[model samples]
Target: MNLRDIDLNLLLVFDRMLAERRVSAVAQSLGLSQPAVSNALARLRRALGDELFLRTAQGMVPTPLAMQLAEPVAAAMSALHGALNQSTAFDPATSTRSFTLAMTDIGEVYFTPRLMERLNQVAPGIRISTVRNTAVNLRDEMEAGQVDIAIGLLPQLKAGFYQRRLFMQRYVCLFGKQHPLAAKSRLTLKDFASADHVLIQAAGTGHGQVDEQMAAQGIARKVRLVVPHFVAVGHILQSQPMIATVPEKLARALAEPFGLAVRAHPADLPQVAINAFWHARFHREPGNRWLRELLTETFAEG
Candidate 1:
C-alpha cells in the first residue's frame, strides 16, 4: 500500500484490464506482448494483495475487489488522458479518428443520414461505424471504449454514464395512403383494436408501448404481421393494408418515400425520450466530445 512503491504504468494496465477483461485483447490495445500483459497482471496482483481478475471459460471475470476499483481507476485514467490532451487542438477537418455508435433500427434510420451529412461537410476525414443498441452490455462496451456513443432510449443506463436528451418522440400509426384507415383524421380505440396490424418486433418477444397501453384498457390488437425490424414496416405497409405504430420521426421519414400516411395512435402512449448515452470516461475526450456536440445540434428538436 506504499504509494512510492507503485508504478503508475501498472495502474494504467490495471484500468485497461478492468475494462477489457481478456489478457490478449488488453495486450493488443496497450501495444504490449501477451507475456508483458501477464507480467503486469502478476505485478498488480502482488502490489494490490488481491487476485483482481479470475480466468474463466467466458474470459477474465473481475473479482469483487476489481469491480470496486473499476470506477475510480477509470475516472483517474480519463482525467489523466484529458489533462494530457488539453492543449492538443482538435481540428475535425484534419482528424482521422473512427467512432462506433450503437443504436436501434429506428434510431439509425433517423440519425445516420443527418450525422453523416454534417460530418462529410465539416469532418471529412472522420469515419463512422454502427451497431444495434440492445441496451445490453452497452455499459461494458462503452467503458471499454468500443462504442463511442449510443443514440436511442436508454432508460437503463446507470449512474456513471452521461446522457443528453436530443428529442421527444411519440407513437404514430403508419399505413399505405390507399389503405382503408388512411382517410381517418384520428384513429379510435375500436378502429385500432379491429385493424390488421404490423408489429415491429425489435426484441425477440416483447410488445410495443402502444400495445401495452392498449392492454391496460382491456383492448387487444389483431396483430397480423410481426417483423424483426422497423425497416420492414415501411415495405409491408406499402404492399399490404396493415397498420404499424412507430416513432413519429421514423413515420415521417418513410411517409413520402414509401407513399405512406401517419396518424396519432388511438391510445395515449407515453412519449419516447430519445437521448445520447456514453460513458463518463469518454465525456471529455476531444473526438468524442466533437461528435456529441454535432449530434446534439443536429437532432436538437427538444
Candidate 2:
C-alpha cells in the first residue's frame, strides 16, 4: 500500500488497542471516542489489506500481520514522543551555531574586536561570519536566514525590517597628529574649508551623507584623494596631511593606533545613530534574541 494513503494517526490506535485488548481502554487512553478508535483500526486494516485484529470473547485478538507490525509501530511512537518533548531553548554556551552578520567596514572596525572578546568569554562555541552589506542584498539575506543581524547605518534595511538604536556618533575631522593644523586648539571654518580632504565615498552604507551635509552648510573642502571605505582611511591619513571627516567612534579607535588626531568639525553636522537590524521573521528566534541582547548589553548607550 502507498504510504500516502495511510494516516499516521491510525498507527496510534493500532498500537494502543494491541496492548489494551479492548476498544474502550484504547479510546480512553487516546482521548478518542470508541467509534473513532474502531474506525481508525478499520482504516488501518483496509490499507494493510489484512484483518489486523479480530474480535473475540477476550476483547480483541491480533492477527499475524498485526503481530508483525506491533514492535516497529510501537518503537516509532516512542521516538515521536521523545522528539516532541525535546527542549527548544537555545543555549549559547553549548550551541555551535554559526551566525552571519552584515556590516560596513566602519562597523567591522568598531564592533568586531569587543564582540569576539565577549563571545569568547560566554559563548566560545558560537562563531561569527561577517559579509559586507554592499556585496549582498541586506533584506533578502536576512529574510532567507543567510544573515542573522546587521549593525551599522543601513538606510536600505528600512520599510520591512526592525531596528534598535545602539548609540549616537558625531562626525569629526581626522588627520595626522604631526599635521600643521594639529597644533591648533580648534580648527577654524577656513581650516576646514581650505584643507585637502580624503573623500571616503562609502556609497552603499549611507555615509556619503557626511559630505552632503558638509556641502549643504556651504563648507566645501578641497578633496585631494577619493576612496571607497573607512577601513584604509586611517593608514592613508597617517602618511598624508589630508583630512578625513569620519564618525567619532572610528576616529577614537584609529587615532592612537594610526598616529592620527581628531578635531570636531568646524561646521554643524548631524550625528548618525548606529542601530542593530533584523528581519521580523527572526524576531522571536532564540539565537537571534540572544545576539540582539548581547549587543545591547555590551555596546548600547544608556
Residue 170 miss distance in model 2 (angstroms): 0.5
TM-score: which candidate is best? 1
Question: Which digits, one per residue and each the tens of the lDDT, describe model 1 over residues 56-151?
Answer: 998899999988988888888888888988887789999899899998888778889988999999999999999977856777899988999988
TM-score of each: 0.91, 0.71
Kindly give the number of clashing pairs for every candidate: 0, 0
Tell how far residue 172 is off in model 1, in angstroms. 1.1
The local distance difference test score of each candidate is 0.85, 0.85
lDDT of 2 by residue, 162-259 (tens): 89999999999899998899998799999888889999998788788888887887887898999988899999999989998999999999999999
TM-score of 1: 0.91
Scored against the true structure, residue 265 in model 2 reaches a CA lDDT of 82
lDDT of 2: 0.85
Model 2 scores worst on lDDT over the 10 consecutive residues at 78-87
